[model samples]
Target: MTAAQPFVQEGPDWPGLRIFATTRAGGVSAAPYASFNLGAHVGDAPGAVAANRARLRALLPSDPLWLDQVHGTRVADADHEADPAPADAAVTRVPGRVLAIMTADCLPVVIAAPEAGVLAVAHAGWRGLAGGVLENAVAAMGVPPDAGLRAWIGPAIGPLAFEVGDEVRAAFARAAEPPAGAFVPTGGHDAAGAPKWLADLPALAEQRLRAAGVATVVRSNLCTVAGNDRFYSYRKEGVTGRFATLAWLVP
Candidate 1:
């Protein structure tokens, strides 16, 4: 598989930070995984995954600090850790150290406090988001809520494509002032008469970031399920590969 240029996600709002989220367009994996599958645990060939990482490393300062995400609120310190940690989020205040979060349908959030030399990447599926992964990640940065911080919400299952039952809706309702329009009724009911919903992962993420004191929040607008050719969507295909979102400071 050939190397596909990463979709770079950087802007003046996040100066001194270099960020990129991979697409499924480039690499060596075949068929279901196609190419550019960065996840090692997703049944893809180890060599293919390694080659893909090597290709990705060409554009980074160092290998990304990966995590074993458990859909929980644990946040790991990328700079101090020796190996992959069991956490949903990874943060680092050192330069040249990449913090990565793997996801297919789950929302990939990268938060940065450039002025403080801090960066964090989170894997936020419904369970993680509802359980306060974002809040824990922000708190781990050691910066005040009002600190000059910026966040970018990467692609995930979009609202129109994400159908959930009452339990999912109730979780967000439990949060403080869950953003309006974040969850829309699907005009359908479950077996228990509970209203079904099409949850907006990005909107929900933005709301969480705002509540955590992030001043500016931007979303990739790329939907994994919608852009099947460009992204790996686990919700769309049960047995599929996982792409990643990586972020680090410029040394």
Candidate 2:
């Protein structure tokens, strides 16, 4: 990893597994998508995106299966699927098959059940969370009763920076009541005067992962909105590049 290396390698020290989150630090892109932007659909130059991806590819064992995330609860089978597809999450039991999710402010979650030889990644925004993206990913992993899974929640909009409306709160309630303190009233309102609250995205993700039987859930606690210099932030900049969070089992 050099000063120009784009990834911030972090995750469990488990054997035969590799995980990391990319930063918008080194690449050929310019301006709003300034350098290291991996998302091809975010309006960055196709060639620049490709060049950046090539840089990332050099560091991996195989090409990553990048999903066309739609903020929905669809988990792809990376072991079988060879091409990029429309899904917010992907799981694979095959070693060396990399799974990647691109996000600016949305949560990027990496999950691994080494004993079961399963690895998964998810792109969870509020909508994805309410729609059970995390739950679906964990279910897809199919870890044995005693195998146990551990997850690492990556950079996303922090609690204090992610303001939401009643509908957002209600969405969680309808899906599965969030743990207390997940949403704190901000005592503010949108243009329509609708009540606003600061939602803890990481907390919400941890709650869902635990409910789905993950044994250990760790958070990076890195805020994209706050640390805009290192990570991209769609909420802070409507037109911005996306960073990637990836996971794979060593071959």
Candidate 3:
């Protein structure tokens, strides 16, 4: 197995805060789900996934509170919820309570309010983004969004690779006015001949976070589909494993 190379947070440093997202490197799963597959529900060997988690745990303060991501808006309270539940995002104020969100092509959004001692992570696909998952997570933190809250948009399918249909665009339009250039017409069509537009996942996420009043927003600018060798991308590989993004207060 290769050594794990996770993307560690570098800026807007807050005291006692730890945040990072894993790459596709390291661990011991075989092809398709090859090395470093942390997801248990993605058809990877159970033993392999367990081993991967164990490896990841060795680097964390405690076993992370993993969520059952449903591409919805539910936010789990990691400090109160002992068992994993069906939710797309999680929030915690207690130090050592590591919160995790698994994703491949979907965006992994990490939010922190150092002053309030709160941190949250969300799994945001187009559906969740348009459905207000970020908004919900920010609200769950109990800290005013405009009050020094910062967010990071982790790797996901970039705009050039994330082609979508009118329905997808309509969803964001129905929810809120998306950023002016969030969706750009590709002047192309899919197998069904439907018009396609490249949707910028990170841009959409940034817009939402800013609209929610987050004081600082940063994007990894890493494209999963484009950088599939280093990051898992379901959009690029149909049968693939997932990587995780985690955050916690340093204890």
Question: Model 2: per-residue lDDT, tens digit, 1-251?
Answer: 45366657476677778988888887888989998999888888999999999999988888989888999999999988887568999999999988999998999999889878899999999999888999999989887646778999998899889989989999988868888899999998888988899999999999898888888899988998874578989889999998899889988
lDDT of 3: 0.86
Across 1-251, the per-residue lDDT of candidate 3 in tens digits comes to 56564344333355778878887777789999988999999899999999889888988988899888899999998888988579999999898988888999999998998877888999999999999999999999998645689998887899889989978988888867878888899998877887788898898898889889898898888888874578788878999999888888987
Candidate 1, 58-111: lDDT as tens digits: 888888888988999999988889585589999998899988888989999999
Candidate 1 local lDDT, residue 117: 88
Best by lDDT: 2
Tell me the TM-score of each prediction against the true structure: 0.94, 0.94, 0.93
| TM-score: the better of candidates 1 and 2 | 2
Question: How close is each model in CA RMSD to the real structure?
Answer: 1.9, 2.0, 2.3
lDDT of each: 0.86, 0.88, 0.86
Query: Clashes in model 2: which pairs?
Result: none
